[model samples]
Target: MIEMKEVHLIAKLADLQEVDYHNTLVLHALIELLVEKGLLTHEELTAKAHALDSQLSFQLDLASKLSETIQNRHTQIKPIS
Candidate 1:
């Protein structure tokens, strides 16, 4: 069900994730432009990024706990004859 455009966008985002300091400077410039246009505030951008980091951390911790519980439960299962 994935469209070509969506796949391309995902690839572009992945590339962006791997960007180095120079690319970060370019992105910072774009962020500044957006701020200048009143499209987004610096505080709002940073706040959302922090919130996302916190949310992902919680999800990762929960996933680790769940994985451990699943492994322990699996070990307790009896094989069928």
Candidate 2:
């Protein structure tokens, strides 16, 4: 059974776009939390964060290109929609 912390870590990793992955503020916080929860060792978490950061960079590049092609898009995110 996966722990909640592990589940959240994976989900957040997925949620992070490539550009924001390098945002030290974001990744560091996540890594720190994972470490605190014992879901990952400090070294392991740090290394994984770096790898994810690089992967996110590529994903961001692709998203940027695709964003331009998207028009009149409907956002699922809403406030009282």
Question: Among these predicted structures, which one has the highest TM-score?
Answer: 1
In candidate 1, which residue pairs clash?
Answer: none
lDDT of 2: 0.81
**How well does model 1 score by local distance difference test?**
0.95
Per-residue CA lDDT of candidate 2, range 1-81, in tens?
999999999888887865576696787888788889999997886688799999999999999878855632536445685
Per-residue lDDT over 4-28 for candidate 1, one digit per residue giving the tens place of the 0 to 100 score: 9999999998887778666889999
TM-score of each: 0.59, 0.34
Clashing pairs counted in every model = 0, 1
lDDT of all predictions:
0.95, 0.81
Q: After superposition, how far is residue 32 of candidate 1 from its true place, in Å?
A: 1.7
Candidate 2 RMSD to the correct structure: 15.9
Candidate 2 positional error at 37, Å? 7.8
| Candidate 2 TM-score, C-alpha based | 0.34
